[model samples]
Target: MPRPLPDDLLKLPHRRDVPFAKLTTLGVGGTCRWLFEPTTEGEVQSFVRACVREGLPYKVLGGGSNLVVLDDIEIPVLRLALPKEVIREGTRLSAPASYGHIRLSQDAAKAGLAGLEFAAGIPGTTGGALRMNAGAYGRELVDVLQTFRFLTPEGELVEKRPEPGEFRYRWSFLTGGHVALGYTVALAEGDAEAIAATVAVNMEKRGTSQPLSKRNAGCIFKNPTGSSAGRLIDQAGLKGFRIGDAEVSPEHANFLVNHGHATAAEFAELMATVREKVRAVHGVELEPEVEIWR
Candidate 1:
């Protein structure tokens, strides 16, 4: 028998049987059995501490832009609902992890800040960006990240700069039980018009090359060494490949898109097929950039 949740956890803002398809950008997945949306940092910390104390495992989710859930999640899932406030102190901007990534980039651009220009097209929340070191056009979250605050595995809070080997390509050490709350970015001053123009250009590029009309969890795989994953997949002639409603995007071969009514099983199968085809032809393994939850 499973242990019951702590009494303190039941009072937080939450929902039951929320559809995963609704939460994630891909718009396909099983239901989230327990979706807790804590509106304050104290509520978030309390939930985590309770889980740790009771030997319960939990997952922290943000915008759900980069996740693929294959089955109904039974474990407790927490999504921060911090107030939507952005503060600019000096050349630094701080926001809760729940802040939208692309919107935050646009906000920074509008404020004449320059460092977040690369994040203009990245989806998900700021917390997801920091966790994955999300990047585009050669710049990443780690580049502008000043410092972040997160709950440790043992439910202790810490604020510190990312040390060497902490943040890597689409990966971070803030896994296991650690949950990021918020972070600050170190940006530079730039002309408002110039910053906005740069963001516009980035957005245009993404729209032209990506399969934006279709539902997807952003890029499906990480780029292999010395080459691009999309280029490799395109080269292998896998574009438009389909498994049920899941297809390797005809626009960008690296992206797996969900046509209407696509199933999680189909998505998984499509991903496996693409990986196999790429490995067979190019002898390169394509690691998934999107996190899979089962």
Candidate 2:
């Protein structure tokens, strides 16, 4: 059994049987045991400290775009949503792990910063992006990351600056029990008109190639070396396949969408099917990009 939660943490506004469907882009999930939305960096650290002190199991949530929480399991959910005071300075931006990446990208663009244009279409937060080294169009977070602040499971705050090559394709060292406080991302200067134009072009391309309006995670699987996951799935004839309300998106075979009211179980099943088919047809294994909670 999990340990009891700290008194201070319990006093916060925590909801029981909280529906995760509304929190996720997929719009499907069961109820969570507890949920807390901390609106400040200090609050995030304190809450994490409390959970650690009490030895309670907790899961950190960000924009909810790349997660699939199982409905049948019961677990505590903590959302570290820092306040809007989190700002992007000249070439550096600091934001809570729970803050949205799209908002950050737009703010940076408006500020005339040029390094994060690749993140304009990502639907997560600074913390999540750092954890996954989220990137697009040949640009990655590691390329712009200056440093990061994280709260250890022991409740201590530490700043980390990884050396070059510490981060690899779609992977980072921040996936452990540490909770991110915020980070300073370096950006270059560019004309606002040029930045806006670039953003527009990227958004248009994403809309044409992805199922942005659908209830789906941006990419279900990571692309393998010199190849794309969507191409592999398409070649395997897995497009338009369905398992319950979950379906392999015909628009992008790598995306699995919730047609109406998909369940986590159904989504998992569909992913397995796609993986099997792709592997059998192409002799390559597909890896999930989205995090699954069971």
Candidate 3:
């Protein structure tokens, strides 16, 4: 059995027995035993320090996108609730990790800044995007990322420019116990109307191509080297394939949608079947892009 959380850690703002269904975009999985919401960097540091001192394990949750919880998590979970303030220094804009990804893009457009229009349709918070190095339309967060602040595993804060290998396609070095606090993006000044138009176009493409009506945890698998995962799954005829309430989306095979009452087990089974069939047909093994917490 796991040991109880220390008293200092419990003093943070938190909720008990919160369902994962409410915390994730996939809308499945069991309860989160303890969910801690730290509203400031100091609070976050305190939580991390206390957990480290007690030798207790904990998990950090962002906007809850790109994740699939397979079962109830008993460990204390940290979710930053930092104030959503944006700081602007000329062409650079910075925001707390808790700020919405899409909202930041829109804000950039409103400020007559370009470069973030591709993020207009991306879901989740800035911290989640940073962790995933999220992208769309051949543009990624790293392209415009200038500098970022994060806490080391030991709870020491550091800010610096990204180095090579630190950020890559749909991946980043901000793993293990590193916690992103905020980020600055260098953008080019542009016509507000033009930027808004570009953002709209991207948003429209997302709305049309993705199954917006369904509950999903974004793309289920990462595209292999030069091949698209959606195309491979579709060619393998896995689209619309269902195991219980989980189905490979007919609109986009890369997405697995929940049909109201889908369970985590059903989704896992469906993903496995899809991967197997795709491998059998194409001889290419597929890997999941979404993070799964079992």
Candidate 4:
């Protein structure tokens, strides 16, 4: 049973029209019913507690780089924009997940810490990265995570140290009903110049392979077993495919970009068409990596 929301909570200025297009990298989506951006962990906890007490449904928002909100519906969205504060204790670093990956990597590099260089090219917050076990060049978040702090649905703060086997290519058990507050990462000593160089190389590769300059989610679909999604898409003749303002990126087959003035409906239609064509030709079902909201 859901409880009635307090009037004051609904009156909060943070709870106002939020354009999803501005929130996401794809630049397509309708307005949300409400939007809340908490700048501190304590405020996040408080906001979560209030929602729980009122039995109000809420969705947690991060960098908004890999999600699609349907233009036809309205929902409450909560954004946790915690301040960046990385503290080092020996080889372990504790910091909020809202800190962008580039910032985290730069901080770690300055401290001569290795193991996070691979994340420098990932354009998302630490929380979003952790949620998807985001990885590239054979390295992942599971490799560096020591522990994490999360808020349960009941608004209780809990600490967890997930085991290695608990994570998969782009998934983990920590997906639903839990909002990541921060994480502790373990790093090893390494040559600062060497680590920086590796990061630079990876970034260059990503720039060449991905449509970073365009409005698009990183990857539309997950890679199938023993194959790459981009390869399959390219083989299926989906590269440069267009529907309205949406098109499968000519630069990267797996990415769908919004050239300009694209709508969420158009993007959805393009995705559907691509999936159907790919499935019909290759006998393979494509699973989307981007989270869709309605």
Which candidate leads in TM-score?
3
Q: In model 1, where is the ten-residue run with the lowest total lDDT? A: 1-10
TM-score of each: 0.96, 0.93, 0.98, 0.93
Give the alpha-carbon lDDT of every model: 0.89, 0.81, 0.93, 0.82
Clashes of 4: 0
Name the weakest run of 10 consecutive residues (lDDT summed) in model 2. Answer: 69-78
Alpha-carbon deviation at 154 in model 2, angstroms: 1.8
Question: How many pairs of residues collide in each model?
Answer: 0, 0, 0, 0
Q: Write the residue-wise lDDT of candidate 2 on 31-60 in tens digits.
A: 777788777767777777777766666787
Best by lDDT: 3
Model 4 TM-score is 0.93
Q: For candidate 3, what is the total of clashing residue pairs? A: 0
Greater-TM-score candidate between 1 and 4: 1
Question: What ranges in model 2 sit over 4 Å off?
Answer: 1-4
The per-residue C-alpha lDDT of model 3 at residue 26 equals 90
| Tens digits of lDDT, candidate 1, 1-294 | 545667788888889889999999898889898899999888888899888888889998988989998998888999999998999998899999999998899889888989899998888999888888899888889999999999897888899988899998888898897889899999999999999888889999999999999989988898887899999899889999998888999999978899988899999898888888889999999999789999
User: Residue-wise lDDT of candidate 3 within 1-294, one digit each (tens)?
Assistant: 767778898899999999899999999998999999999999999999998898887888997889999999999888999999999999999999999999999899999999999999889999999999999999999999999999988999999999999999999998988899999999999999999999889889989999989999899899999999999999998889999999999999999999999998998899899989999999999999999987
Q: Order of candidates by TM-score, top first?
A: 3, 1, 4, 2
The per-residue C-alpha lDDT of model 4 at residue 208 equals 93
Writing each residue's lDDT as its tens digit, candidate 4 over 114-221 gives 999988977778888878888888998889999988888777898989776778888876665678888999999988999889988998998898888889888989
